[model samples]
Target: MIKLKRNDKIGLVFFLAFIISMSLVWLFEERFDQEQWRSNPGKRYKMAKNIIEQDLLDNKSKEEVIQILGEPVTAEFSDNNILIYQLGTPPSFFDEEPQELIIVLKDSKVIHVSVNQEE
Candidate 1:
């Protein structure tokens, strides 16, 4: 076997560490993003409103949402046929527009969820 220079050995260790650390982060990153997404109710509302107003329902499946909401309003086809379901209508205050909860779905499952806020 050929001998590696000291710096080369260090670089190899760093590269391996980076690969391993990033792999772990990638595995747990979803939980981190979802943690706050669930605690904040206002965010969930806005997300739902966006799904309906902006026509992002295509990102999720209708049947999946039906299981959650028990029905749907109207929606077009999703690019990958994933199911997106907004949980609740926005809570309005001071006669302002109501914020809604946004639910993101993938492969007929709820993957990401959040809410929208009005300023």
Candidate 2:
């Protein structure tokens, strides 16, 4: 049997630890849930990735978007057709800026959706 050197063994342990930590993080990640999204504002960031990637709001009417995501934080302005939904601050070791779900509307229909830091 081939024996590993002390440094090699230490490196292997560190690598295994890293892999295990990443696996745990992935397994515990939150998925998109309509009820959860509506009820849990602080956890919205956990599911925002899924909503954006799936294009759930693509081409949806403003009213339909309200029904799905509830009333936006900002009122509809005549100058700009955009909606902002607060996603709250993500859980982190360091203080991070709160996030927002920005939905751009054109002709009363959703055209773009993105998550960005609060300004």
Candidate 3:
């Protein structure tokens, strides 16, 4: 039979607590970042608007969007050759209230873009 000593039990308890705390921190960090981002919806919306207005929609590529917006929060490519660039808080935490930018691409070129701000 295997037996754990008193020190071993103490170490195990501490290790479990440490893991739980880390998991909680990791989960909450995303929520905190989203809260901070949503707090400035105007700024984020303006950024998206500028990307659509100034850039040449017909010639703009994915790389160009990245250059203009730094990076998107999420991206999705469909089988129908449509690419979507989503910016703002992820949907996991902000399920009911979420904001995002939808950039539609056709043949690797920007065809349409829309800023969706959920209230």
lDDT of 3 at 99: 58
- Please give, for residues 1-119, the per-residue lDDT of candidate 1 as tens digits: 99999999999999999999999976653221233445553345433534444444344454645543443322336553333333344445654554434455556655554554323
Rank by lDDT (best first): 2, 3, 1
lDDT of 3 at 52: 56
In the range 1-119, model 2's lDDT, one tens digit per residue, is: 98999999999999999999999988987778889989998889998898888899999998999899998889557755999999999977886999999999998898999999998
Q: Show the lowest summed lDDT stretch of 10 residues, model 2.
A: 71-80
Question: Which of 1 and 3 is ahead in lDDT?
Answer: 3
lDDT of 2 at 85: 91
lDDT of each: 0.49, 0.90, 0.58
lDDT for model 2 comes to: 0.90
Candidate 2, residue 58: the lDDT equals 92
Best by TM-score: 2
Per-prediction TM-score, please? 0.34, 0.72, 0.42
Where is model 2 more than 4 Å wrong at Cα? Answer: 1-27, 93-95
The candidate 3 region of ten consecutive residues with least summed lDDT is 29-38
Mind giving the per-residue lDDT tens digits that candidate 3 earns over 10-86?
Answer: 99999999999999976654221334334564335434544556553446787775564445555665433334444
